[model samples]
Target: MPVTVSIAEFFSSLHVSGQVGVTREALLPGDSEQTQALLSRAFQDACDDLPGGLKADLECCHAAATAAIHYLYRVCQALVDRAMSEEQVAAICAAMPPLPTSPGEMFSQDLALRHLPELWSMARSMSDSDPLVTGIEQAALRFPLSSVGIALKNSPDLLSLRRHDGLWRLYIDRIIARQDALRLEDASTALAVADALGEHAHSLAPKLAARLALASAPALSAPSILSLHP
Candidate 1:
């Protein structure tokens, strides 16, 4: 079975001390339930590594981590703080690899930017929406090669889409299309999107889409965008 989680249990699992729980819970906007669930699962897995029979200490550690995770979620919430629904997270995770799997897996993997472009690109809006993920990007440095490769090739279209202003257009069609004919639900796509976006894809899609729409332009100027993350 998919180890699904409930909002209550998710929060409880993180609150070892029961102290951070109430405050953290109090600040949360109800729309963040899904991200909360994701983080709860992540911390729960992290706590699983406690040494043999150290249940007491484990609880302590779990609570602290839970608090941190909760705090992190709160941070993510305030960043964009918009309503990024669970359906979005599930849809994204379905195509991406199992999220880090554990705490060590979370930060220890040393994942090369070369590995996760699609996920990264997809996360762009999500990341911008949630500062937690954005901050994580700063520390995690998520600029995979494939994402960069795709972004650069599409640069001309990107620049032409908008001259000097730093506006980004979000192309729902292109986004959906890129996910077509390929395994968007796989590890490669995650890595691919990140790779393609590198510094460009993730940051610029919104600009391109919005600008072209404003100018009443035909499909994006350059065909390069199509070739990316393909």
Candidate 2:
């Protein structure tokens, strides 16, 4: 999807046109106007306490929700394909945290992220010893995003974007390979998905950074790795 309409902007425009903010009252069936308003208001409220104003909140909310929604939709569809009912779907949804207001918010604010060890242990039997695509894949197991930064792109071959550098290229290919199974993009995939991606998949940041430091990308000043948002 080439970026769906930004719920925030859509809402702002509606306000400009004299429409009120979104609310439960606007969620009338088939009322596109009301539906739009609800989405905007919900998104706005979702960020009420975050640092930046509407725009920042929207960025976080949009990213997180998309990440959560994509996975949920896929799981939901598969279950539905198997003739699952609403209750079954609800059960599965119950397994995850509330849908994030945005992918960034989930990455930055969630506490479940600290449980990656538990997640990785669970995936040990599946990927058969860290096949690849580990870091980004872990996001799913965590069930929402937490900081998995652009540093993930670093690889020894990279001329810039040194953080993730070489290891990133290989991971990207694996991610491409696994994209069908996991409904995430590089930017949106979470740490849980990375850890739980394949049993063998180790967090790529350390491995990649060690390589770059060796290849003239400055030494590992400290034990380097992907920084999770706190």
Judged by TM-score, which candidate is best?
Answer: 2
Q: Estimate each model's TM-score.
A: 0.23, 0.24
Give me the candidate number with maximum lDDT.
2
Q: What is the lDDT of residue 18 in candidate 2?
A: 26
TM-score of structure candidate 2:
0.24
Tens digit per residue, CA lDDT, model 1, 84-130: 45554333223322233332332222122122343345456554554
TM-score computed on alpha carbons, candidate 1 = 0.23
Kindly report which residue stretches of model 1 are placed more than 4 angstroms away from their true locations once superposed: 1-60, 79-123, 126-134, 139-230
What lDDT, from 0 to 1, does candidate 1 have?
0.34
Q: Any idea what lDDT model 2 has?
A: 0.35
Q: Model 2 — which ten-residue stretch has the worst lDDT?
A: 153-162
